[model samples]
Target: MNHWDKFLAPYKQAVEELKIKLKGMRGQFELDSSHSPIEFVTGRVKPIASILDKASQKGIALDQLEEMQDIAGLRMMCQFVDDIHTVVNLLRNRNDFEIVEERDYISHKKTSGYRSYHVVIRYPVQTIHGEKKILAEIQIRTLAMNFWATIEHSLNYKYKGMFPADIHMRLKRAAEAAFRLDEEMSLIRGEIQEAQAFFTRKKELKQEEKN
Candidate 1:
């Protein structure tokens, strides 16, 4: 079996259940949006294991990772950067999830220039017979971060992270620009939402006038 199948095959339902639980967790923070569904990203382990295999060949022991499933990795996409903080705070309150680590990658972007909020939470879940501890990694990011990550990922694949120097520079520039744009766009979103609400009120008033 492949690396992921080896780890996830036995825990398929558990994985999905965790996804549901995670969505509820986000909802508790009031950051839950209609568009956010806990994504199932299990197949990503293949490349990860390959990286680990490379480390092993270099004389590093990484066997434990291969069998690890509760490595509870999740990405929670939010509407704004502020929502990221909101979600993090909500996770912190619960006794069920013991916070193991917290990383504000949004403030301290990755070396590759990625940005997001990461929280490692350990929550106890009930099973058919007893309760079990499940480790879940929650990554909260704005839609802009998600867009940037998706585009950068495609470019990383298309050019294998080794594009022409000029192209790489442009990508970096775009990512930075996207960061600033995210804030501006978020403000515009609020304005637009307010405008829509106003329009709806006017429409309701006009209908009432006709009646």
Candidate 2:
């Protein structure tokens, strides 16, 4: 195995285990025929090249890159604005991890108009040698906000974070629209959650009958 491969093995394991645990939360909500705050979960271990780039950009020494909380990242996408808070609370109550920090970009947004709730956690991973503590970042956001951020991230990549003036202006406007959409969705959240819960019960009934 290469040096990078060996170094990232534990991080990869952390991502996989966390994905299963987080997704299991969604499963529990479904089984209970309740509304799940999380719409979906996704995770990744930052690639070597991206890690190196981030370290260089942030003036982080290579040895200290291990301190980067987002090296192992997981995102929980929610269906409503309030659901973001619900998910964050769930994370806080979990005994498996220790939440060390929280960054409320949703309330105090970014200059680039990004919004998300970020939590830095220390999670224990069982390795052959022993249990190891690893830092991971959990980002929770409404789907609308995620959509805007994904597009902006792609454009930022294309423009190398220095977009032309007009493009930047348009992107900011789009971000506002995305936030508005989230607000509208939140307004009707009760009706939507009821409909989803009803459908879940009906599906479960059908499964019981089939069995």
Candidate 3:
């Protein structure tokens, strides 16, 4: 295996296992017919090119890439702003992973108006050789926040962190709109949850009839 592949193998394993575990939590809530704070879980190991770029940008030595905390990243998307907090609490209560640090960007947003709850964690993965501890980052955000952040990320790539005045202003405005959308959704979260539960029950009844 290439050096990058060999180095990233443990992180990849960590992401896969964590994705299953986190998704299982949602499954449990579904089986109980309860509202799950987690909408979906997605994960990825950083691409070698991106990792190199980040390391260079941060003046991190390539040999010391282990210091790159987010090389293995997982994102937990939520339906409402409050759901973000729920997911964060769930992570805090978990024993399989040790949360090393937390960055609450939602309350104190970035200058670019990025908003997400970042939790850095150290997780152990059992390998053929031995147990390896891998650092991973879990980013919890509402769907609206994720949408905005995705767009902003793409724009950052295009602009290379040098956005024009107009584009910068528009991005800021869009971020505000996204945040407002989350707030509006939260206001009707109870009704939304009830509607979802109703549909789930209807679907279950249909399945029973088929059986």
Candidate 4:
């Protein structure tokens, strides 16, 4: 009954382990800001791998299937670009995981208006029975970038790969705005964090005085 269920177990295992890592990795994106608190939204997109075999059964190639891999994705939408880079660097420094590939789509966006920092890494997860290397893709981007990307993707899927001219222009404009916004936000974040630390110290001092 289960023809290729074996490959599925490892894929599912890999995805589950990745979800756990992403949960723990959430804290890495949060930072105190003097004006406003910064928080990142983490999301995962997982496509059914069984679709691959189904595609093959329908006389489709793996390459074509990859283009159709619009699902099975994860997005870490950050408040600032620095946090995006911070998360990327944090992953790079880790010894427990190895980076298989890195694509800076932020700098080099796709022609279809896609923008995000994508990294493919293999992290070894130790289970009760044994250890396994799970390959997963991590996308780091600012909230603005996510906003633009989401809209464009939705339209693309809706139109079935045919986007109108106005839609394309809007996406480009949004991408530009997102870039500028991320920079401006980064500068403000640094200033606010400094102020927060000062306030925190002041509160600590007052508590000490009462004690």
Which ten residues in a row are the worst by lDDT in model 2?
29-38
Where does candidate 1 have its weakest 10-residue lDDT segment? 36-45
Tell me which of candidates 2 and 3 scores higher on TM-score: 3
At residue 51, give the lDDT of candidate 1. 48
How far in Å is the alpha carbon of 9 misplaced in model 2? 0.6
What order do candidates take by lDDT, descending?
3, 2, 4, 1
RMSD of each: 5.8, 1.4, 0.8, 5.6
lDDT of 1 at 14: 46
Using TM-score as the measure, name the better of candidate 2 and candidate 4.
Answer: 2
lDDT of 3: 0.94
Cα error, residue 124 of model 1, in Å, equals: 3.8
How many residue pairs of model 3 clash at the backbone?
Answer: 0
TM-score for predicted model 3 compared with the true structure: 0.98
Per-residue CA lDDT of model 3 for 99-187, tens digit only, reads 99999999999999899999999999999999999899999999899999999999999989999999999999999999999999889
Stretches off by above 4 angstroms in model 4 are 1-6, 25-38, 41-45, 49-72, 125-132, 194-211
Candidate 1 lDDT over 1-211, as tens digits, reads 5866644432444456656766675454335323222222221223455546455655655665533433545677766676677667766886655888888988898766688887866656566656666555667787778788888879887886677888777777877887898788677866755675578669879999999
**Where does candidate 2 clash, by residue pair?**
none
Candidate with best lDDT:
3
TM-score of each: 0.67, 0.95, 0.98, 0.68
1-211 per-residue lDDT for model 2 (tens digits): 3988878888999999999999999999978767888899999999898899899999999888778889999999999989899899999999999999999999999999999999999999899999988899999998899999999999998999999999999988999999999998888988988888788779989999999
Which of 1 and 3 is the better model by lDDT?
A: 3
